[model samples]
Target: LFHTLSFFYMLSSFTSSKISYHYHFINIRKNWTEAQRFCREMYTDLATVENAKEMNNLLKSIKDLSYDVYIGLYRSNDFKWHWTLSDSFYNGEIFKNSKHISNNESCAAMDNNWKWFNDNCDSQKQFVCFNGKICY
Candidate 1:
């Protein structure tokens, strides 16, 4: 009886720690900074895609495929990249293969190809947001 109870407790703990995120696509066009502000006020924050799975989920959430959208990634004045959602999972290899990235670009956006690309932060674009609660 003790062993069975222990197994159940462990199972419950595992299930509770598993987090599921919800992605929200906002169609209004705005610059990266404005997009971030809007997301904070309305939903959570700019979308943070940490891995291939989250990237796929983000793509699936968007209803319109007509235009590119801003994401949470941006580089500070010193050129250090960071996500607006500070707790976002970081994937170092995310932009390794992207040929579109240039040294001057600091903001990130999801193009029609569903891949990340560096863009000018001042460019107006639609953006996505995720719930602030981290499931894990």
Candidate 2:
């Protein structure tokens, strides 16, 4: 209904570099850290959107355009966005989501419309998990 929807779940995946990543959606709601923990336990890490194409593909894959789901992006103490998976995939900021970010919000979630949002790390929301493999 709104951008602040409390609960929803879905998954998506793609390949990059020497890694073949498969993304999985978690239906349960959990804080960002907890989601990361769950992802690390069962998968490689939270979903990593390496570029604009991947983000767009994820949005296009989902049926609903109203859900706010967590991705692998989090704000570091250096005031930069980082992927939960390997940091090598992201060299620089492709989009300027940080200028709008604040001090309190550290984790990121992307709406179905593909807009990035910074939220409190403790806020509960649906998330995606990805497992990667070395491509041969």
Highest-scoring model, TM-score: 2
Give the Cα RMSD of candidate 2: 6.8
Q: Tens-digit lDDT track for model 1 on 1-136?
A: 1232232232222212234557899989999889999988988888875544565678788956689899888765544566776643333444434444465477888776565667888889999988856553
Model 2 is weakest, by summed lDDT over 10 consecutive residues, at: 4-13
Model 2 global lDDT (CA atoms, 0 to 1)? 0.66
lDDT of 2 at 86: 72
Question: In model 1, which regions exceed 4 Å deviation?
Answer: 1-19, 87-104
In model 2, state the lDDT of residue 21: 61
Residue 106 displacement (Å), model 1: 1.2
Task: Supply the TM-score for candidate 2.
Answer: 0.72
Q: How high is each candidate's TM-score? A: 0.71, 0.72
For model 2, residues 1-136, the per-residue Cα lDDT tens digits are 2232211211122224566566677777898989999999998888876544444445544556456788887777777666777754233433344665566687888776555677878888888887778878
True lDDT of residue 98, candidate 2: 60
